[model samples]
Target: MIRVLIVEDEPLIAEAHRTYVQRVTGFVPVGIAHSGRAAMRAVADAAAYGTPIDLVLMDLGLPDTSGLEVAAALTGVTPSPDVIAITSARDVAMVRTAVAHGVVLYLLKPFTFAAFRDKLDHYREFRASLPSNNDTTVSQHEIDRALSALRTTDLRASTPKGVAPQTLDEISRAVRAAPEGVTAADTATNVGVSRITAWRYLEKLAEDGLVTRRSDYGRAGRPKTRYLWKTKHAN
Candidate 1:
């Protein structure tokens, strides 16, 4: 499993991020740190326990110091964790600095669960493509695919002729809000669209790798194909 440490000053936002991390498959929240100092301490404590943290969701603004400085400090750690900036800071210069400091992903604030999950999913794919054993040299094709996984593919560009982006967003929101997951009929009712229209949006999301479709066998007759948000890490 991928152990994650959340470094955010805001308590509520940190809690929300913790929840988001739990929803993904292959990842688990190791601990939360409200400041840079606390983050370093948490990292040490995790290492002491023998399970070092694998990833860090770092907010650029911290009460003690800037997240960039924290990232620099982590460079000297014995088992350093990969950092992903999760902050509202959109300054290009700050982003460039973060990239220089070894941040793998930069996620903007006020994002939906779908967007958040997409980032982590991409990260997972990138990590999965790495050499399972260090001795094996990475082939050029493997290297290219791993790097490509980190880049977000624009799902909007692939939208079919008739589906409106607004409708798709609405359908995505409805499904994401449903923790137990939602079917096309449920999405249709929530978004006030026809079942077929809702299914079209759900299918689009699934095709874009933002959602999952499964067979619901609970009901007696004709097992309905249920469309659910794919927020969890896949096995």
Candidate 2:
């Protein structure tokens, strides 16, 4: 099994990642670190314990230090684990920098479970394509085949029907702006859509693992559903 380490600052998000990692076959979540220092320590401890991490799901924004810095530091580790950047940052420069620091894959924020699984599956295929023995040398064609396994198709194709990307963006922004949480009615008012329409988008977000659903029981009548943006960072 592939030992994995998750480096995310947010407790809820980190837990979600851990759960996702557990669901995938042949992958085990060995540790979770909320900061760069903690991540480095975890890697070191795991290595010392004779179960080194094989993959790292790194979040770019950390409370202590930038994830890129941690990724760079990890390069010095013997039998370095492959890093896959998971972040909300979309800046081209950041992407280039992450690649330079040896990030094998880049997964943007607000992704669905399907997308997340696809990434892990691709990484597994990439590893399978590689030479199993350390002393084995691979040819150019073999190298190309291994790397090709990591390539992902366009994500837009996977989006559910009837969900407009623009409207989804607007709804997501409204939810993120509300620190406490937002109901479908509130989202409808903020995004200039009907309550049902807002609810549909909110449900989609929840299904995608971008936002969380909660029940508001303080009200007099039946409990109302509230949607809380999962990540601290805005996508």
Candidate 3:
């Protein structure tokens, strides 16, 4: 299995990344770090213990320092782990800098399970295409094939059938606006939809990993199910 380390400042987001990593067949989340320093310590400790991490799912907005700085520092360590940047930043200059700092892949925020899985799967393919022996010299065709494995098609058009993108956007906005979480009824009122309609969309969001579901038992009678947006995103 490929060992992975999750580095995100937010506890919930870090846990979500850990869960997502575990869901992939060949990946295992070995640790989670909430800061750049913690991430460096975890990587060093893993190396010291003789079980070095193979990959890092790095979040760019680290509290202690920029995630790009962390990535650059990580490269100085022997047998550095590959980084796949997971962030909300879309600045072209940031992307260029991340590439210079050795980020193998870039995944934007508010992504679904399908999109996340696509990236991991592509990385696996890329790794598989590489030569197993360190001393082996690769040909031009072999190099091309390995690099091609990292390419991914656009997944923005991949929403499930019967779900309108406009309505999904509205539901996402409503959930993000409510940091405390929202019930289907609350979402319905906010989005101008029926309770049942809101429930269906919320379920789809939960299934896609964009939102999390929990039971609210404080109220009388049956517990109400609430859905929360997984991360904070710009409107």
Off by over 4 Å in 1: 134-136, 154-195, 202-235
User: Candidate 3 on 56-104: residue-level lDDT in tens?
Assistant: 9999999999999999999977668999999999999999999999999
Candidates 1 and 3 compared by TM-score, better number: 1
TM-score result, candidate 1: 0.71
Pairs with steric clashes in candidate 2: none
Best prediction by TM-score: 1
> How badly does each model clash, as a count of residue pairs?
2, 0, 0
Those runs of model 3 whose alpha carbons end farther than 4 Å from true positions after fitting are 157-235
- Expressed as tens digits, the lDDT of each residue in 1-235 for candidate 1 is 8999999999999999999999987899989999999999998888778888889999989999999999988878867888999988888998899999999899999887767877887788788888756478988988887877788654556778998866876787687677678888888899999999998889888877778888989757988877776543232
Give residue 22's lDDT in candidate 2 (0 to 100).
96
What are the per-residue Cα lDDT tens digits for candidate 2 across 1-235? 9899999999999999999999887899989999999999988888888888899999999999999999999988776789999999999999999999999999999887766876887788789888867689999978988787787544355468888866776787688669899999999999999999999999988876778999999958999999997632122
Candidates' C-alpha lDDT: 0.84, 0.87, 0.86
Say which candidate scores most in lDDT.
2
- The TM-score that candidate 2 achieves is 0.67
- In order of appearance, the predictions have TM-scores of 0.71, 0.67, 0.66
Minimum summed lDDT over a 10-residue window in model 1 is located at: 226-235
Better of 1 and 2 by lDDT: 2
Q: Give RMSD (Å) of candidate 2 vs. truth.
A: 13.2
